[model samples]
Target: MRNIPTRHTAGRTIGGAVAALSLITLTACGGDSGSESTGAAEKLGENEGEVSILAWPGYVEDGSTDPEVDWVSGFEKETGCQVTSKVYGTSDEAFNLAKSGEYDVVAASGDLTLRMIAAGQAAEVNTDLIPNYEGIYDFLKDREWNTVDEKNYGIPHGYGANLLMYNTKDVTPAPTSWKAVFEDAPKHKGQVTAYDSPIYIADAAVYLMAHQPDLGIENPYSLDEKQLAAAVDLLKAQRTSVGEYWSDYTKTQASFETGDTVVGTTWQVIANLIDPKKAPVEAILPSEGATGWNDTWMISSKSKSPNCAYAWLNHISDPEVNAQATEYFGEAPNSDKACEFASEGHCETFHAGDEEYAKKIWFWNTPINDCLDGRTDVECTDYQDWTKAWAEIKG
Candidate 1:
């Protein structure tokens, strides 16, 4: 649902050229990169030129040789466009570098998509160039942040839950709520780890949405003054249980494997990483529906090889590519077709393709006034308040 922190925590996303995974298409213009019409079709031809991509670790890396994952070659072969990527450690990193217009495209998160579009850091995508976008779920179609006035900027990628994972062999009566790592976490002590970001404030906010209805909280990110205070106070109260705030996926896996932690927030991929036989780990949705995020692929307004980028976008959406991404990346494919080719035990074992199951689960969308519950009157507290509250909660 969020990012797996890497070197990008250093503040910039543009790094060395390493081959990695590819991404998707677009919609509206929130801000102007040029005076071009958002509706105009920009042909991304395979000029056999080069394009740069700013993305996450596993998206393009194949783990074949040096950097571990090697997906860049396939994209190059298929499109004849050379790809060079800077694998980001955090969304903030990509957002910053992308703002410079130095790179072509980015794998943006829901939280930053709007910020990027507003800043004119990314280009509004022409859906006509990327036909596969039509397959994206309507839920992601056009929204306030990624799209402005019905125009799109990002191609819907994939997503999974930020679950409470545990060492199944050791933990019994499996913990079901965020409380296992927050409220009742004292017993776990050194074994507990939490997400190392202000964004995690949303976890507490979501919990409040489910348990503290009297608080009158709606969107976890859209906290009013009183609502923000409550979320911060709840986290500050639960701070003692937070032993570590994890930012790296490899380290997170190590924490569980070493039995250093019994329960904490983690992505679904972490569950698959735990040895099913040795140390069993499970992704608990919790009794209350959980908060999560979807990874989206958005085109760069300045991409020289925009055509090749669009090709990669559609390629990843294909059922086979989507299935491959799931097996290797450890997240569910957003495309319905991709879920059809879910890896072994993925569909039956995890309901990987169950539309009914997905509906029952709340996918994280960027918080906006067309509130998740659909009340248009409430105003979400600005981001500054969220920041101040995050510091107080984690302090």
Candidate 2:
């Protein structure tokens, strides 16, 4: 019942409704708030009996997907908050669904969280209500995507980086950089695979950041039109050698196992799933670093069960539960303590709580016109532009 990470889909337009949402200046710590006047709950009320949740698949389990993978039941049992959950495939889908105001809580990736905030769908969270928040890694807290104007919008969930994965048997002269999938891709023509998302463009930008310093690409998410064009050009060139553009976990695993794909961008989870006997593979955060995701759990502005929603957040952040959830999803736990409850060697495998290694990743952030890298001289292209460019790259 393992599932792939929920990612944005290419060519899916961010319609006028979403595009028209107010644009907020994204800052490293706390900057300004352009979002609607929605404040965090001052205190929790009695249990609301039931709380609805919208999240990525495998995030909220009740022993339904797999009898052993049940996290919701315990929350319901302990808090008296009956948990009703819905799963979303992509960030766009989650954004639209969250706008309905039906679900009390929604688990969103970095790309979707800001949009929810701008649209007045997400409420600023009073992290004080959730004691477990203190145990979370400081690096994962109060980021631009999940926090605005010094307000907390949600709790950090799990995070993992997009890595350079290559078959040891087919890819010789071990790849220490992403050049294997960008510049040197043609060498393994028709055998290289890349992530099937516009966000994948950031992977190329990461490479340029290290190898093509002349481009001045400060942040992968904040790309000007020219910078985006450069990334598009690199991806377009890599496209010729790409055997398949993959988002589905099974397909990519199969390709690597059968030798159809020898090199590409992959999640550590996908690399772990591959059978070493059939396809010896290694996944690494290349020297150039990588694009990754740090999902957040935010409450809805119109939530009917605010107390229950807050309770759920606290329950999930417990070291034991956090360990179960993150390990099951194959990402780094948010805290060092959670590592203790996780399977032996799990933290080492994912590098949980390693701040130095964490710094190496440019966690996915929504691209906006106001450059996230603090460049005011030029406007950066937004996700909409990236979507259109992705279509062009694929074609």
Candidate 3:
């Protein structure tokens, strides 16, 4: 049976105050702010009998939330690793919690993975020890966010796109592009919604990359001042039409149901939750492509249960387990095999294992002064800039 629709908060923005403080701290100490952790394990040892996990809500279910929704119990029963899991509301919170060295493992979104690695919170993951890792999609392996300098840092979990969701009865001709929310937003004035976060700036950047080739925007997350300004302009214009900018899933669902929102950016899970009888809606990955997130399960650098951590990683990656966890959280499973174990039509709904579709997504990444797109000549805007810009755009 499908689990209840719980909002999965992985890639949402870190609060402005927290972001400003983090940026100041990173700058004061330079980018290399934390000690590097020891390398990946060369061999496994006996189970440590316990493991603590920091993860997004619903990612590490032990039936505490709902008796029928759980995958952790089996892992504990089989591996003898009593699981204690904490759910984090955002990547920044996960980063702070993981740094406490209180977690043996962390399910990190791309935006938080590199930060964790930089802060000495993530240990290199030895995929050889995770046999199920071989089954994960190739496109997900060694990505910029989860890997640094060709060394893996974590196992791929699941992913989902920030899709364009619109009221079917209200939207005409079946919108296939993000233009509906950008240039055409005025048509749905006072009814269009958008994600409320700085990372969402990347969505505008993605739209710009396709419509304005002269911007030379190779990566949405790596925008220079001019490119960022162009995106900011687009967003500022869009803000005029936006009914509400949302970080809460239930609010978006309710808005759509009540006809307060006719068109806007949304997640597939929210689309699933809307009562079709109240408001007909459809969510699609627009033709211009989209921004999304791929979360990873990383072993903690200061893990007190390294053996159990490895066991938990491998256990969770098993196709059936991965399916249960990802489906519950409403995202594409990481591997083709995992799709088979997912509920009927779930894989198709999320486009699991579709490498071509995956290519169109620029997964969430922490914007830094050093361009993620590899342009050394010009400095790109960092998360701090994005944070400040987001406030300006929203205002």
Please report how far candidate 3 places residue 348 from its true position, in Å: 2.1
> On a 0 to 100 scale, what is the lDDT of residue 69 in model 1?
46
Model 1 lDDT at residue 370: 25
Q: Please provide, for model 2 over 177-284, each residue's C-alpha lDDT reduced to its tens digit, 9 standing for 90 to 100.
A: 888998899999999998787778888888888888899987788799999999999999999999999877678999999999999988888888899999999998
Number of residue pairs clashing in candidate 1, backbone atoms closer than 3 angstroms, sequence gap of 3 or more or interchain:
18
TM value for model 3: 0.88
lDDT of each: 0.62, 0.82, 0.82
Between candidates 2 and 3, the TM-score winner: 2
- Measured against the true structure, the TM-scores of the candidates, in listed sequence, are 0.82, 0.89, 0.88
- In the range 167-244, model 1's lDDT, one tens digit per residue, is 776666777777776677777877878776666777887788878899886456556667778888887877777667
Candidate 2, superposed: residue stretches over 4 Å from native:
1-37
Model 3: lowest-lDDT 10 consecutive positions: 1-10
After superposition on all CA atoms, how large is the RMSD of candidate 3? 6.7
Candidate 1 lDDT score at position 192: 78
lDDT of 3: 0.82
**Which regions of candidate 1 fall more than 4 Å away from where they truly are?**
2-40, 46-48, 62-70, 143-145, 276-278, 348-350, 360-362, 365-379
